[model samples]
Target chain A: MERVTVILGERSYPITIEAGLFNDPASFLPLQSGDKALIVTNSTIAPLYLDTVVKSLEKLGVNVDSVALPDGEQYKTLSVMDTVFSRLLENNHGRDTTLIALGGGVIGDLTGFSAASYQRGVRFIQVPTTLLSQVDSSVGGKTAVNHPLGKNMIGAFYQPASVVIDLNCLKTLPKRELSSGLAEVIKYGIILDADLFDWLEDNIDALMSLDEKAMGYCIRRCCEIKASVVAADEHENGVRALLNLGHTFGHAIEAEMGYGNWLHGEAVAAGMVMAAETARLLGSFEQTDVERIKRLLVRANLPVHGPESMKPEAYIPHMLRDKKTLAGKLRLVLPTAIGQSEVKGGVAHDVVLSAIGCCLI
Target chain B: MERVTVILGERSYPITIEAGLFNDPASFLPLQSGDKALIVTNSTIAPLYLDTVVKSLEKLGVNVDSVALPDGEQYKTLSVMDTVFSRLLENNHGRDTTLIALGGGVIGDLTGFSAASYQRGVRFIQVPTTLLSQVDSSVGGKTAVNHPLGKNMIGAFYQPASVVIDLNCLKTLPKRELSSGLAEVIKYGIILDADLFDWLEDNIDALMSLDEKAMGYCIRRCCEIKASVVAADEHENGVRALLNLGHTFGHAIEAEMGYGNWLHGEAVAAGMVMAAETARLLGSFEQTDVERIKRLLVRANLPVHGPESMKPEAYIPHMLRDKKTLAGKLRLVLPTAIGQSEVKGGVAHDVVLSAIGCCLI
Candidate 1:
């Protein structure tokens, strides 16, 4: 078992990583004997893992209920979250009830925000099934449901009580979803951890093949990098903005393409390339570094560029609606190097457009 | 001007009380010259005060926008808040935008929750016009819109940057609305300030007549008590629950009667008497104290008993949905004396029934 602490003062909790942790209720979570645990999954993951999760919670004497939402990123919206709220109210779930987010990033984001708003707020634990969630979304407490105008435009910074990642769950992950997780795993390396970036370059095949040790190391390192950054700036007022390295451009792609049409990690993978291209043009990044990032994303089977159909100028409208926009200026996290990034606002419209242009084809 | 500070560490802000403060931008709010300030009021208040508030923000060189929602407690719902969200996105409001909630509790709650959820969260200022909001909702950071199933069932604990209370606004209040505010004023006296209770008794006639100084003191005192309680428990984990002294029973009344049918404060006024009666039967409160509370409520023109249409059994359904319920047990705040209260749970279901029966007129 591997454990990492997300230090958030008194609200801090541990993220435990181990195989088959989902089946052992006694050791996985800190739930009390009488706590009501609602496992929030999706139609897809529920059949695969719901019974095991429920039986585990029942073993710990937790009153268990389950609500499986319709699966997909397109279902991540306020309207969908309202259904979760309806389920909770119908079941007489109180403030003390513990909500367990039991699937991928979409489920985690929706469940966390639902817990944040239901009866004002409630305690929730993260049982992230997807690699994208276990490495990024589930650890940071950045929970939200997307609005039609923007991706993740409506949400809160509510943290989870605990995060339990069972590596065995990944064995069932579709090949496409596995690559989606690697996009974020690659993100941690490019933004803050140079060593992890190099490690990814060497162990790419092992991670893709679902080697147990390589997978565990990849998830743990990404969480550690995320935990450190989130601890310093929970509200994203400062260095936390660095975590959105590709998100501004990526969100534009997701919104313009319509959510769930393209996976979040796929959009982010292309967006990161656009950011690196922007940095290269601005004289902050070497052309070789940009090529290296593109090469790795291509090898991992992720998108290496924006949609060929979307003209560079088309992304501006959605980018304008991006949450990172400060004082009407489009603030973006552009990479200065493979192991470093900085938030740059007020970049000229043409410069942003040209960067997107560089990424097409 | 009088000021009370709600100390929540870095999130703390002042509650400023004065006459004609709305027009004095220099003396009000912490807004910057270039910040976009969105004034959110209801239709009822827009015709009366929206122009003045916009001009005030304009005087400080703030770029201003305004949204006027329909007035009424029934309008306080997630759908209504969604409209506010739409207005914000349509107007291209960004992270730096400051939302000013300018109306009664309904408008304040809707706007505050909108602020809390819009773009994840944004800074907001509270300009509570009615006494209910001025004293209670505005002082605490409790923000939410109601669900069809429950009052304040969906919300957040997002605090404001500042709370502005202009005594002049209350002069335009309806007589019934003024009485509704008085109910909460009397609540502060009963729960934590015996002196405020005596003061309400002595000045009931003057307050009913809308005496300026009397009304100012009443609102300020209530704010001070609320500020103190919220500072200790921003999330309502401990001492903060006491602030909901009669709210469980009151929420039941509000939810059952249809939210707009019975004003929140009016229901709370009657609910307070029910709580007193329960305490009296439990030997935690004296009969004389119950009479004192009821007499003061009546003198202030507030309801002193439950609606005859709602039988004891009718409340159980709604009470079960109350946010205060923990571990499936309905935790209620009951007065142990004239000026002190305690959280009491596990009372017999029949005991609760008879208590409601005692309050039915």
Candidate 2:
């Protein structure tokens, strides 16, 4: 097992990445034995992981309540949070009760949010089950429900008490979901670590085959990079924003396709391809590096094209309208190379529109 | 002006209590002068205070955006948060944007939740207009929207940059609101300050007429006590839970009353009366002190009774189901006297039933 802490001082919490951390989350939970806990998951995962997690927590003789919402990103809304709160209220959960998010990013985000909001927050453990979740969303303390206007429009940078990553769970992830997870895996490499990018390139086949050793390295390395960034800037007020290299464009794609339709990781994957092309056009990176990024995403079996339903004008307005944009200016996190990123502001509308034109509709 | 900092170390922010802090919130708002400021108000307080706040922020060269939702507790839900999020998206608000909540508790809670959730939190300032808001809700970092199953069911403890409690607004407050504010005023006396109880006892008549000196003293002292407790515990983990003296019962009443039927303060005032009587029965306090608390509530025109339409069983079921209770053990914050409180456990269900019996129609 590998342990890394996001040094948010008093709010700092640890992230444990290993093959079977979920079975013994209580061993590392930041609480005394006998404290109550609420494990939040969804239909798809609850049937598989609930008993294992409950039994693990039961070893501490702690009382645990389970909340299982409908599965899928479509269920990730304020309505779902309502159900979680109802379960917490019905079970008489209080200020001291710890919440365990025992599913994918949707479950982690919603449950973490419930923990943050439930009686104004309680200790929560993130037992992220999905590849997309384990690689990106679960590590950062950003928990939110999608708003009608935009995705993750309502949330908080609520740090998790601990994140228990059981990589074995990835064995059950669908192929498409695995592809989506690769998008974020590629993200860490593109925005910060060229060595890891080279590693992903070298071991692409092994990663695709779900080789335990190969997958473990990628997940641990991704979390390590994320942990360092989050510790330096817990809130994305500065360097944290760099983590959104393809996200601003990725979010625009998801929004245009109506979130959950394209899958968060798939959209982000295509978005990264577009970002690479944009950087190449702006002369920020060697055309060869952009080619490497595109090749990696293609090797991951992820989509490299966007939906044709939205035109360049549609994407221009949507991307520029992202919450990450500042003062009506587009703040695009463009990659200068596989290991470098720059937050370029005031990019001309024509430039962005032209970049959107590069998409394979 | 009196300034009290909720000494949360690095998370601490100032609470500036002055007659017209609203006129120039930018002075204390933690933002660059030209940064965008989104002021979220309600219909009731918008026509009166929004323009003043907007003009002040704009005068300081802060780009301003304002959105006024329906004014009432009924609007304090996920639906309303959507409206605020939409307005923020439409205005191209960013992580750097600051949200100014310029109304009572409902508006303050909704706006704070919006800011907390918007881009996973932007900066926000509280300009609480109602007495319930100024002294209690606004000071703490608690921010949330109510769920159909519960009050404040979904939210976060995202602290504001500053809280401006302008006493000048109290003069324009409705008589019912002034009385509602007193519920919280009485709460402080019961929980942490005997002097506040004596002050309320001595000046209930003066306070009813909105006496400037009496009201100012009540607001400042209540804020001071709350500020201290919150500084000690920002997330209601322990000491902060004590501040929910009548709130568990009050929240049940609010949820049962469909949220807006009874003013939050009125429900809280009645709930406090029940809690005091419960303490008297539990042998936690003297009958005389309980009576004094109830009588003071009555004199202030605060409701000391529950609605006849709601049944005792309806409330008890909801009360037992309160988010404040944990693992089916209700943690009621019973008042021992005007200045002390203890969070006791193992209170019998029969005991709570009896307390509800007193409030039964």
Candidate 3:
């Protein structure tokens, strides 16, 4: 077992990575006898692992309950969240009850947000099952639900008490979802770590083949990078914006394609390529670096370009409405190099349009 | 103008109390040229003072937009907040845009929560127009919308950039609403400040008459006490719960009667009386002190007992569902005396029932 701690002062928590950790009762620490816990999982995940988690908490002598929401990203909305609130109110779950998110990103985001607003905040633990969530979303404190107008339009920066990552769960992930998760793993390399990028290039097959040793190292490195960034800027007032390197374009694609049609990491994969191209056009990034980013995404079976039918102009409106846009100026995190990125404000619309035009199939 | 600053470290903000602060451009400090602001007022307050607020911001070279929601506490729901979100999205209001809540507690809470969740947080200013709001709701960072099962069940603890209290607005306030505000004014005296309680006892007539000097001093004192409490415990881990002295019972009354039928302050007024009775039953409080508390509430024209139709048993379920309930124990803030209070956990349910029965008219 490998452990990495996110150092956020009072909000600090640990991320434990190991195979078959879900079946181990010790993975859930700080939850003691007589404590109450609610496991919020989706239908798909509930059938596979809900009982194991429930039994684990039961082994700790904690009172446990479960609510299985419908599966998928489209289900991540305010109305769906209301069901969780209803279940809580119906069962009389109070502030002391700990909510355990036992699925992938959708479950983690929704449950974390429910915990944040339920009774003006309650404790929650993140047990991310999918690779995408295990590497990225579940580690960060950004919990939100999507509005029709924007993605993550309604949310909060509420951290979880801890995150438990069981590598064995990855065995059940769909091939497409696995590829989607790789998009974010590739993203960390493109945005911050050149060495990790080289390591991915060398060990991509080992990771894809589910080699436990290789996967453990990769997950630990990604978590370490994310933890340092979050500890430095928990509110995204500065360097933390770098983490959204592909998000502005990714969000635009998700909005244009409609959420769930294009998975978040897939959109981010294509968006990262677009950002690299935008940087190349601005003379801050090289053409080779853009190709390298595209190659890794392509190798991972992820989309490296925006949808063929989505005109370059379609992204402009959504990008303009992005949370990153301030004072009508679209600020995008553009790559300056394979291992470096910076937030660029006042990027001309025509330049972005031309870059999108260049990236489309 | 008299100013009291809530010292919350980085989130600290000043509360400015004056006769006509709404029309004064200088009252809105830190908002500069080219800034965008959305003034979220209700139908009732929009006709009265929305234009003055807009004009003041415009005078400061701020590009101002306004949205008037339906009046009343019943309207403080997620759906009403959606309208505010729609206006923001339709106008392309970005994160840089500030949200200014320009009415009473409902508007302040809905708008503040909107700002807290919109784009994962934005700057907001509180222009509280009611006495309950100015002294209680606006000064603290508790922002929420009511759920059918609970009051403030869905909310966040996001603070405002500043609180601008124009005392002149109270002149147009309805007689009942004025009495509603007095409930909170009297609350500060019961929970944390004996001198403030004594002063209210001596100057109840002056405050009821909207005497500017008396109102100003009363508001300043409440803000000071609230500021100290909030500063000590921003997330209610400890001392901050003291501020909810009457809220658990008050929320029960509000939820049981259907919100807006009994004003929040009116319910709190009666709830405080019940709390005093409960304290007396527990032998920590004197009957004479409870009588004095009742007499002061009567002088302010606030309710001193539970509604005639509400049974003593009805409040138990709602109180159990309160956010304050931890580990299935109903924890309540009960007054130990006229000016001191403590959070009593594990209080017998029967004692609470008898207290309600005794307080019921």
Candidate 4:
């Protein structure tokens, strides 16, 4: 087992990664002996892994119950959170109850927010089954549900008690979902880690092939970067904003395309290209770096350009409403080099328009 | 203007008490010039103070937008929070926006939770217009919306930038609302300060009559006690639980009776009496202290007994689900004496039954 600690003072928790940790309750959850745990998963994951996870907890003398939500990003809403609450309340789950999120990003986010809001907060553990969650969403404590107007627009920065990532669960992930997660993996490399960017370039084929050692290393490195970043800025007041490298444009694309139409990482992949293009126009990033980023996204089977249906005009309104915006000014995270990024706010409107135009297919 | 600081480290904010501060944007809001402010109120308060609050911000060159939700505690739900999101998105409110919760506890809670979850949170200010909010909810940062199954079952501990409590608004409050606020004021004295209890007894008439000095002192004292308790235990891990003196029983009453039916403070008044009775049966409290509590509540025009319709069985199910419960044990905050309380978990179920039977009219 490999472990990474997110140092958030007293709220800090561990992220454990192993191939079959999901079947090992002792290693998988941060639950106390005899604790009551409510495992929240989706229908898709429940049939496959819920019983094993449940039995593992029961073996540890922890009382266990389960609530399986319908799978899909479109179902990530307050209504679903209400459903989780109903299940817990119906079963008499109280403050002492532990909520274990046992699916991918959507489950992790929904459960985390439910834990954050239910009874003004409760203990929750994350068992992320998808690469998108294990490497990113499940690490930084950015839990939220989608709004009709935007993606991840309603949520909180509530940290988890622990995060368990079992790569064996990824064995069942469809190919498209696996590719979707690579977008975030590529993100950590592009926005902060130059060495990792080079590492990804060297091991792209290995990662795509599900090379255990390579996938484990990639997930750990991204989590380490995220842990350090989140520890320093849990509420996204400063440097933490850099982690949103492609989220501004990506959110616009997702919002425009309608949530679940374009998966989060797919939109982020295209969004990163637009950010690089914008940075290039600002004379900070080089053309070669932009091309290199495009090449990587292509190699990873990710989109390299924004959707043709979303024009610059359509992107501007959503960008303006992004959480990154300040005083009505756009705060875009742009690459200065392959491994470095900067958050530049108050960029000219025309510059953003041209950047969006540049990324159009 | 009178100010009490809730010392929550970096999240610390000031609670300012004065008459007509709501119209004084410069003193009431912690907003910078030209910041966008979203004033969230209910239909009741919109007709009373929305324009004045809006004009105050507009006077300060702050862009002002308003969303008036339907008035009443029942309206405090996720659907209303969704409405808040729609209004903010429609007006292009960004992270820099400051949300102003401008009504009673319902508006403050709904708006505060909205700010906590909007775009993963934006800055929010509390301008509580009712005595109930001004004394308690606005001081503590316990923001939430009610679920159909429970009161405040879904929420977050999101603090405001500042809380502006204009005592003049109490002039417009119905007599019942004034009495409701007095329940919390009486609670501060019961749980933490005996002297405050005596003072409330002495000034009950003055407070009921809306004497500015007495009411101001009452509100400030409650806030000070609340601020200290919240500062020591922001997440209610220990001493903070003491602050929920009558809340467990109160919440059960609220949920069972239906939210907004028995106003919060009314239910709390009755719940506190029940708690005193329970403590008495446990030999920790005297019958006289219970009568003293009952007398003060009666003097304040508050209920001193649980609803007759809610039998001990009905209370047990809801009480078992209270946030105060731990490991299936009912953690009841029973009064040890007139001036103090203790959270006693693992109390006898039959004892609780007798206490409820004792308190029922």
Candidate 5:
């Protein structure tokens, strides 16, 4: 078992990474006898893992209930979350009840948000089953449902009680989803850690083959990087903005393409390339570094370019509406190097258009 | 002008009480040039005060926009809040933008929750136009939108940057609404301040007539008491729960009768009387004290009893679903004496039913 504690003062909790941890009752630490929990998964993941999680909670004498929402990122809306709220109210769940999110990013985001707003706020545990969630979404406490006008436009920075990452769940991940997860895994390397990037390059084949040791190391390093960034700036006021390296551009792609069409990680994968190209154009990042970032994403089976149908001008509107835009200036995170990035505002419109133009083919 | 600072460390904000504060640009302190603000008012308040607020911000060189929602407690749902989100996204409002709530508790709660969830979170200013909001909702950070199954079931504890309370707005308030506000004014006296209770008894007529001096002092005192309580326990982990002296019962009355039919303060008024009676049955309260509580409520023209249509047994189910309920044990706030109260869990269900029965007639 590998553990990395997200040090957020009183809001801190451990992220435990291990094979078959979901079936182990002890992995759900801090939950005691008589605790009530509602496991919120999706229709797809529920049939695969719900019973095992329920049995684990029952073994610890915790009263448990389950609600499986329909699958897909398109279903991640406020109306869908209402179903969780309805089920909770119908079951008479109260302030003391803990909401356990038992699926990928969508489930974690929806369940965490339900917990945040249910009775003002309640404790929630993140049992992320997909690699994207286990490495990124579940660890950070950013819970939200997408609004029609934007992605993650409506949400809260409510942290989970603990995060239980079961590596065994990865075996069931679709090939496309596994590659989607690698996009974020690659993100940690570009924004902060050069060594991690080199490690990925060396062990890419092993990770793709599901080699236990390599997969475990990759997940743990990403968790550690995210935990430190969150601890330094929990609300994304400062250093934490670096974690959103490709999110501004990626959100534009996700919003333009419609959520669930291009998976979040895939959009981010392409957005990261756009950011690197933007940096290269601005003379802050080398052309070789931009190519390296693209090569890695390509190796992971992720998209490295914006959708060909989406004209570079198309991303401008959505980017203008991004949450990161402050004082009417669009802020884009641009990579200065493979292991370094900075949030740059006031990048000229034509320059951004040209950068997107460069990534099209 | 009177000021009470809600000392919540980094989240601390000042509550300013004055006549015509809403129209005075200076009352909106800490807002500067180049800042953006969106005023969220209701249909009722928009005609009366929205232009003045807009002009105030414009005078400060702050970019301003306005949205008027339908008036009434029934309209304080997530759907209505979505209107605010839609406007914000359409107008390209960003994280730096401030949401100004310009109405009663409903508007404050709806707008605050909108600001809290919009783009993860944003700064909001409270320009509470009703006595209920100025004295209670606006000062605290409890922002929420009502669910069909419950009131304030979905929300967050996001605080405002500042609260601007205008006494002049009260002059336009209906007679019944004034009395509704008095219920909360009377509540502060019962739950934590004996002196305030005695003052209400002595100047009931002055308060009823909207005497400027008396109303200002009443609102200021309530804000002070609430500020202290909130500072001690911002998340309602301990002392803050006492602030909901009659809310458990009040929420039931509101839910049972349907929201907007019985005003929140009116429901709370009757619920407080029910609480006093329950404490009397428990031997911690005197029959005379309960009568005094009822007499004060009657003098303010607020209801002192639950609706005759709602049976004593009807409140039990709603009470069980209260946010205060923990581990299946219903927790309630009962007054031990005038100006004193405690949160009691495990109170016998029969005693609660009998208390509600006594208040019905």
Candidate 6:
């Protein structure tokens, strides 16, 4: 097990990464007898893993309930979260009851948000089942439900009690979803860690093949990078915005593609390509570095390009509504290099448009 | 002007009480030039005060936008807040935008909640227009929108940047509303202020007559008392739950009566009368104190009792939904003496039922 604690003063908790972790709850999470626990997942993963997780929890004397939302990025709305809320209320779950988010980014984002708002907040554990969530969304403490007007417009920065990353769950995830998850794992490399990028370059084949050791190393390193960043900027007041390197453009793509029409990680992978292209145009990034990132994503079997359906203009309206925009100024996070990035406001409309066009070609 | 700060370590801010504070924004809340400002209010208060506040903000070069929601507590839903979110996105408001809640408790709670949720929170100023908000809701920084299933079932304890209680707005409030507001004023006296209770006893006639000076004193004092308690226990972990003296039963009444049917303060006033009776029966309070509280509420023209329509059984479910419940235990705030309290969980169900029945009678 690889361990990293998010140091949010007294509110901090640990993120434990262990292959086959479901067999031993005590090593990762503190359990109490008769504790009411809800594991939030989706239809896709429930048939594969919910029974095992529930049986394990039941063995620990925990009363377990599960709410499996429809599978997809489109389900990450306030409405879907209401399902989790209703389940909690129906069972008379209180502050002491723990919520376990046991799926990908969509489920983690929505469940973490539901836990954050249910009775004004409750303890939750992120037992992320997919790579995108285990590496990024589950670790950041940025929980939110997507608003009709903007993605993740309503939320709270409530940290989880702990994160339980069970590598065992990933064996059932679809190849497309696994690649979708890789886009975010690739993200940790692009904006924060050069060494992780080098490691991804070396182990791309094993990770793509779902080698347990390779996947475990990938999830642990990504979480470690995210944990360090989140510890410094829990609410994205400053340094955390760097984590949104591809998100601004990515959200625009997801919204334009009518959400769930595109997996979030797919949109993000394409958005990263756009970001690198924009950096190259701005003379901030080498053309070779941009090509390297595109190839790295391509090697992971992830889509390394934007949608042909979206005209650059179609994305402008959605980007304008992006949460990063302040008073009509769009904050674009651009990579200065593979290892680090910057959040700059009022990146010219034409620059963004041209970059969107660059990705279309 | 009177100023009291809810001193919650790094999260504290001043609550300024003055009649014409809004006219001169700089003295109370000076906004940085060009800062995006969202003015949240309802239609009823919009025509009355929005323009004046907008003009004041415009003069200072603040980029102010208004979200005028439908009036009445029935409209204080997540759907209503979605309208505010739409306008915020339309205007491209960001993390730095300051939200000014420009009406009463509904506006303040919704606005503070919107601020809490928008981009994971923005600064908010409470420009409370109603008596209930000025004295209690404005000071505590609890923010939420009603769930269809429950009142304030979803929310956060996000504090405001500043609170501006312009007592002048009360000049337009209806007689019933003014009476409803007195419910909270009566609450402070019952929970933790023997001196304030005595003052209410002495000035009930003047307060009933709506004496401006007396009203101002009462509002400011209640805020000071509330501010002190909130500062001590910002998230209702301990001392702050005492602030919910009548709220456990009051929430039950609000939820049972279908929310908005009994005004929140009115329900609380009636609930306090019942809580006083319970405390008396439990030997935690005396009979005279209960009578004194009821007489003061009645003298101020507030509802000192509950509706005969609700059965005792109907109230239990709503009480169970109260956010103060922990581990499925309904922890209630009961007054121990004239101005002291305690949180007792596991109060007998029959005890609560009998207390509810007594209030209805």
Better of 2 and 5 by DockQ: 5
Q: Model 6: which docking level applies?
A: medium
The best-first sequence of candidates by DockQ reads 5, 4, 3, 1, 6, 2
Model 3, B58-149: lDDT tens digits are 99999999999999999998878888888888899998889999999999999999999887898999999999999999988999998888
TM-scores for every predicted model: 0.98, 0.92, 0.98, 0.96, 0.99, 0.97
- lDDT tens readout by residue for model 5, A1-361: 8899999888889999999987889888778788998999999998999999899989999999999999999999999998899999999998889999999999999999999999899999999999999999998799999889988889999999999999999999998999999999999999899999999989888888889999998999999999999998998988888888888789989999888999999999998988888899999999888888888899899998899889998999999988778877889888888888898989998989998898896
Question: Which tens-of-lDDT digit does each residue in A192-301 have in candidate 4?
Answer: 99999999999999988899999999999999999999998898998899999999999988888888889889999999999998999999999999999999999999
Q: For residues B214-303, what per-residue lDDT tens digits would candidate 6 score against the true structure?
A: 987888798889888887787789988888888878888887778788888888888888788777777778887787788888887777
Query: In candidate 1 chain B, what residue range of length 10 has the lowest lDDT sum?
Result: B23-32
TM-score of chain A of 4: 0.98
TM-score of chain B of each: 0.98, 0.96, 0.99, 0.98, 0.99, 0.96
- The lowest-lDDT stretch of 10 consecutive residues in candidate 4 chain A is A25-34
For candidate 1, what is the TM-score?
Answer: 0.98
Q: Largest DockQ belongs to which candidate? A: 5
* Candidate 2 reference-contact recovery: 0.70
Per-model C-alpha RMSD: 1.4, 2.9, 1.4, 1.8, 1.1, 1.8
Instruction: List where candidate 6 sits over 4 angstroms from the true fold.
Output: none
Global Cα lDDT for candidate 2: 0.82
Taken over the whole model, the C-alpha lDDT of each candidate is: 0.88, 0.82, 0.91, 0.88, 0.90, 0.82
Instruction: Give me the TM-scores for chain A across all models, comma-separated.
Output: 0.98, 0.96, 0.99, 0.98, 0.99, 0.96
Q: Show how many residue pairs clash in every candidate, following the order shown.
A: 0, 1, 0, 0, 0, 0
lDDT of 4 at B188: 85
Stretches of candidate 2 above 4 Å error? Answer: A1-7, A10-14, A18-36, A46-64, B1-3, B18-32, B308-314, B355-361
Best by TM-score: 5
**Model 5 TM-score, 2 decimals:** 0.99
- Candidate 1 is graded, for docking, as medium
Write candidate 2's Cα lDDT for A18-97 as tens digits: 88876774544775577888888888998888898888778867887887888888788877887787787776676778
The collision pairs in model 4 are: none
lDDT by residue for model 1 (B1-361), tens: 8889999889999988899998898654689788887888989999998888888888998999988989999998877777788888888899888899999999899899889988889999999999889999987889988877888988999999999988899889998999888888888888899998888889999988878888778777888899999988888888888888788889999989888898988999989988888888888899989999999999988898898899999988888888888667777889988889999987666778888889877
